[model samples]
Target chain A: MVNKENKFNDIVTDNGKRIRRICSYYSPNHEDRKDMYQDILVNIWKSLDSFRGDASINTWIYRIAVNTSLGFTGKAFKQMQMIVDVDTENLSLLFDEGTKEKLEQEAQLNQLQIELNQMSVIDKSLMSLMLEGLSMREIADVIGITEPNVKVKIHRIKEQLKSKLSGGKHE
Target chain B: MNNSKISQDTNGMGSFIDKLKREDNNLQKIFKILKITYIVLLIIYIPIFYFEIEKGGLFQVVKVVFIALGFSTFLFVFAYAQKKIKKISYAEPTLILLKKTEKRYRPFHLLDLASIPPILFLAIGLGLSEKTFLATKEFFSSDLNLSTYLVEARQFLFSGEHWFKMLAKTVNEFPMIIVFMVTGMLIFIFVISFVAGYLLWVSKYKPIRDNALELIKEIEN
Candidate 1:
């Protein structure tokens, strides 16, 4: 039991930063990202018992992280509908800084995060996994999609991001 | 409209996040209140059910047993929902947690639907038993004795003079009128409970299951 605890702790210590990055990539806000990170850690600890040698510990952890992030977004959307009456489109206008000025002020990564927020849950998971530097095979395993699908999706996501970052006026 | 255009506009994102955080906090508070209310109602209901069972006859006892089973199923769903709510971490990805939460509560929908029939049975059974007891008491206490009352009731029912007249005469002349009145009451209660329970389940619990399933598919695809 003590050995198991030690191993869990070692995994957390080694991969905690990467896990936090993944959480941040999927969650648009700081509070949500913090919650996602904690949830991922707790999930990892809880699911340790079921960890067989079927997959590497890294793949397993990635799977948990990706799935947890996706679940969180779905939950948030539902809760938002129940408790908040604000129209999302109208809410966007209230904070709109115009495309040009806003681009100049925000960091590139923050811009990336904002763009990610607009995606479907599946797309968000795929992009975040790609951003985390997971290989296509690893991403495919975590996402339960084919490696070819992952490559196609990643290429499309990059093109979309590039076009979005360059502004609609083209480079 | 496009991603880059939206990204450049970060001001809305901050306020949006803040609004969501506030809403999430309020949602948690509401859930806590609902949990407490359920516990309180359960506490109040159990003793009342026990008393009813103790005072009731065989039909009453059977009715109470079915009602108790119905309540128990609801309690199981409530307890399971409470447990899942406790396990949820607000800091995590809300979508994923929401999906799991929905999945956890899905079985309760079927349980909710199943509980309706037992409750309808309870209402019918209770009405019939109590009315039968009252009719029996009335027969024994009336000026006419049991044999005389039975003879008059049989004549009133079969005399076949216009059905409404027979009903009216039965009401005036027969001791079994009380039984007929009670049977009417039983049908009324059964219909009301069946309609109300079905409507409540359809409007409330069914949506929870549907929303969860929709979210799961959205996330998986």
Candidate 2:
């Protein structure tokens, strides 16, 4: 029998990118993001034996991710600790390869992240997965919603984003 | 943005990933320690309880206490195991998901499962018991020729000695004893309630273990 440690490794190895994506949503600061990530890993490790292979691997992981993120937010909120707010400039530097036009692009991504934060959790997850290149079907399965519902929700979310961007003078 | 910029974005994300990995290791260590400590405690206490059952007298009380502890441990283990199993099985994910939602928090409902019915029954039972005691005495006095019983009962009804005259025709019987027991029980229940209410007010239900299951799930999720 593959022991728990090996099983835990298999999960992290397979879902590393997905886990990091979820962590990024909850983490505002570098340290907090790290702590939240650790908490998620801990929770996943503790709960792994309970995963009965009924749901697809992705859905099970998403459930744990969502639950852990909520737990992290609740604890941080109690400490009145804000998530590590992404520095738009630093984030821009990471993506902007020192080009003059990079400033404009960085500003857009920062605004996007901010606007994304304003969206509901489901909306955020949907958009984040879409940005990660996940298919609508995969996203729907992870969220336990139908594909049609996913499309509808995505369309509505996009409309909301459009209004927010226009109103805020996204430049 | 060019592909090179996308590459850098991914690189920065990669650095954060390493940090997450380190954090996971630390959490694993903490959980392992906790699990080991609890297991060790169980190992030591189980044997102590086993011997306590053989000591007799005061040890009997100790044995019962240990048995209660053992039973409670079993309950906790069972609950923990089921929670683990349910988490894996996806028995009711929607309910779990709903419980995880923030707007539907219902902390006190958990307590209702165990506390509500018994509390209502206790109040009703005590009330009916007191009434029956009174009605029985009245019926015996009026319907039956229990004049002697009543004369004996009247003596027990009121407090402070009001002795019967030397030639007093005593009708009170031991019927009042039943009334006194009922009244005493009612008083005891009332006192307990008053004390409990006061403590609840003062403590605000410190360490409220049950009835917050949904709330905790909601908040944590």
Worst 10 residues of 1 chain A by lDDT: A80-89
Put down candidate 1 lDDT per residue, A6-56, tens digits, no spaces.
666666667877787676555446677777776666566556656765777
For model 1, the stretches where C-alpha displacement exceeds 4 angstroms are A1-11, A26-32, A46-55, A74-121, A165-171, B1-108, B117-130, B133-221
Q: For candidate 2, write residues B104-218 as lDDT tens digits.
A: 2323334334443444343333244333546565655655545654554445345323233212423245334444444445565766876886577446432222223433442
- Taking every candidate in turn, the Cα RMSD to the unseen true structure, in Å, is 13.4, 12.8
Off by over 4 Å in 2: A75-104, A167-171, B1-96, B100-221
RMSD of 2: 12.8
Model 1, B89-148: lDDT tens digits are 423333455555576555345545665665565555445555456666776676776576
The best candidate in terms of DockQ: 2
Write down the C-alpha DockQ for each prediction: 0.06, 0.11
C-alpha lDDT score of every prediction, in listed order: 0.58, 0.52
Residue B89 in candidate 1, Cα distance off native in Å? 13
